[model samples]
Target chain A: MTNANPHRLFRGGAAPAALPARGGIGLKPEHYQYILDTRPAIGFFEVHAENYMVAGGPFHHYLERIRADTPLSIHGVGLSIGGDGPLDEAHLDRLAVLLARYRPESFSEHLAWSSHGGAFFNDLLPAPYNAGTLARVCAHIDRVQERLGRSMLLENPATYVEFEASTMAETDFISEVVGRTGCGLLLDVNNLYVSCINHHRDARAYLRALPLAAVGEIHLAGHAREVDAAGAPMLIDSHDAPVAREVWDLYAYAISLTGPQPTLIERDNDIPEFPVLAAEARQAEIVMARHAKLEAAA
Target chain B: MSAAFARALLQPDAPCPAGLKTWNGSDPAKRFAVYRNNVVVSLVDALADSFPVVQALVGEEFFRALAAEFARANPPRSPVLAWYGDGFADFVENFPPAAGLPYLADVARLEWLRVEAWHAADAKPLPLAEMAARLADEAALPALRLALHPSLRLLRSAHPVVSLWAAHQAEDVSAALGATDFADAEAALVVRDGLDVDILRIEPGAAEFVESLLRGAALGEAAQTAAPFDLPATLGLLLRSGTIIEATPSGRIS
Candidate 1:
């Protein structure tokens, strides 16, 4: 028999895994085998919740094993939280089932919308920062938290264009939603740098305006550079390459305010080997440790 | 804004929505292209991931153009992209560019079935010994019903889809494709053998038998549906592959 006591795995005394205040990486299918074989000492692993919204497959098989050993974060990419339409209850129900199964240490969704009028764009499109949009985003978060029975982190977006109809700044908008919804901020440093640079705003002032004390996690990813039509440099939050030097610097500054938090290296496209991404995750650890030491000395 | 934004995201040539603006005076048209590029690129990428064999059948460049056209016409309605291209087979049949490869649509269907099989629910198969005991009761055979694995799916086609799919596994796809003829029809059975999915080329009339089983037909009625079926051979394959999850007899008060 494969199991002399299969029941031993579910004794129910093992404390549920928590998101460690260290570095992590996005769990990709290509790295599943490598992650299992090497058992790299990654602090945590985050996966796109939409990817595992399946009945059964190798994804669940490996996740069941790896999740047993390490902390996990479920980052949702398709909730359409900023949409003016009502929340997709069926999707929320699925999220409830998944959260019950995994019980991840952290759950997070974006401040962007992906679907509208029965058509899903499959990309995190931006929404304006206004009273109406803010109230709607808060309501969506409330629904998600109520449905899943847990407070979730909300990530700021990396947007290229602003809305002419906007009445509030992006940072003020996020702060209002965080205050009204009582949800934690994900604080994607890459997004901060990307948006600040794209909008020609001061990155430090932008970070200061954010509700830094409410940050639960941080995201550090790479971006692609391009030229806008008016001959200004535009940066797209393309998680294809290594975490940018500027983004890493911004991460250090943000952590200095929020203290060490669970940071993730978001590499979705042009994914390298597991060890390569792990090494990048280690870089985040080094940055946190360096800042932490300075804080202690201060 | 979403109505205009969602509409514009799918239509590349559509003018940027009225309210969009860049931080600088630079044209929002250029910046809006970023969202346009993301929506179109990501959807095409999802279709490409789900249909790699189809992409291989057609060259990469051709596949991208073909996928982009499909993406624009029929975007994914749901967020879970595992079943994204469910209607690709229908689209391909009417696609004027793929007229030469009439069997392409069936191959696409076969591929989509494989995707479904991969994500289907997991279940425990009935032990072979238990199945043998149940098979021995001839009188109860008429009333016995078997529950197939949740992942089990069938695809029937005039083209040798099983051979075509298996040919992709070979080092020389052209050589493998050359060996199979399209005149013969084939039925493919997809089931989760374990954690992995297995696609088998079921024997003649066996698809009808499997279809009956899938439809909850009784043992004797399902057996009669497939003419001249080798019960031992077919049952051996199904039982060994862990496709039959449960078998219960009817008319039993006990």
Candidate 2:
């Protein structure tokens, strides 16, 4: 492998304190005006960096205006962390420019490879969890950290299938990545529910296996249910609907384990009215508040 | 595992495993098939979103087939699916099925410009008062090299492209809408105002005027480029459209 030699040096700066360990909603176009007027009491906002990765325009203006009032998190979807290929230097440079401009409180990306052999699949795709792939992913993370000059939270992917070549569990893969690269984790609770249900694993058990100490953020989103040929329904992490009851329960369990990390409510499609999403964000706030109160009481 | 499972689950030609991998009475291939379809479909949808008028003119089925073909050839290069169709205009130009709709490729080019403009970097529009005051000093004025907004995009085609695009919108009643001939070439200004992409047709010389500034020409040089046509009206049009966002001082203007 081209990336077998790991240079353990990371020169990024410290994260800003502006990103509160509270709940936020993904800032979609539908809710822009409502967010401006209401200024919902959430922690911070997260946006797809690619959505704002342009030279100039209205999206940039709106984001600049929004960033003035709220701390922002630039969640990237294109880094292709688990690919067998070399790191995309141009994409990272574009990302670095965005990071410098936005001064986002935190940055994150998924741990799945969306591109292979130069064809980028927009969806987060799975990767084998063997030693070779792990080293490759760690090297990529190190390069990303060095390029952006900041540590990023790597989100676990919601995968439907696994390769037979996998030598370690998903949690072990994530933990090993963190252990080797010192990168943080953005544990998407809905993904745990989706992947667990799809792969026939227990969601709670999967959460328990996670390196909770390395968890820096959490994501909660809606998922769709589809029945395959055998009349067995599988959960799809669609992010279009409201967070499922079980996923919320899993989030509560995650808060108990990870101690109330910054959480986000992500709805990319079939987005509802602003108040509805704020109400969802408030659900996370309630969880964080409840957990904080419990800790204070103890 | 069959070759079907290997191609469907893993990348093409990857080694096939010899057993059915199931944990909860579900075939892994059955599940993997959904994701593969979703990945391809979502990327195709992204291209469609970036080129709606092209899709509209071509119709959904044709566009979907075209998109699927394009997807196979130029799958997205970035995770940001929004930027996936940057090269689509060129692809449409070379596409066999779309060869009949010669203007269709230009329309796709215009739509892609709209996306580019809409997502371009945000910069503060120069305050009207400051610009007006700056214009008062001729020495300061000509020396000023205007900064076009990131969303400002200029496109030129040998076809009546603007009316073609406008016909797709609800309000325009222009007769020569979608069926304009390639002989009726047109130039256009695609700029983002606030959050909306505003596309306007420019007369023969007007596009040249703005293209000068966009090409990094200073005010005087840009005006010279627009001189073959009337320069003042073209400059006024650009100003009104909010095309120029800022200006760098050329010490010589002072």
Best by DockQ: 1
Off by over 4 Å in 2: A1-18, A292-298, B1-20, B24-26, B121-152, B171-184, B193-196, B209-230, B244-254
Candidate 1 local accuracy as lDDT? 0.86
What local lDDT score does residue B170 receive in model 1, on the 0 to 100 scale?
88
Judged by lDDT, which candidate is best?
1
lDDT (C-alpha) at residue B129 in model 2: 70
TM-score of each: 0.94, 0.84
In CAPRI terms, model 2 is classed as acceptable
Candidate 2 interface RMS: 3.5
lDDT values, one for every candidate: 0.86, 0.78
DockQ of 1: 0.70
lDDT of 2 by residue, A1-298 (tens): 0222356554222223347888787988777777778777767889998887777655676778788978788899888888778988989998998899889988999988777666677777777788888888988988998888778888998877777778899998887787777677888999988888877787888899877877778899999998654667677888889999998888988898877678899999888897788788889989878988998999
Clashing pairs in 2: A55-B121, A56-B120, A56-B121, A57-B120, A57-B121, B1-B18, B139-B253, B147-B246, B158-B185, B159-B185
Indicate the TM-score of model 1.
Answer: 0.94
Candidate 1, B-chain TM: 0.93
lDDT of 1 by residue, B210-242 (tens): 898777787778888545677779889999899
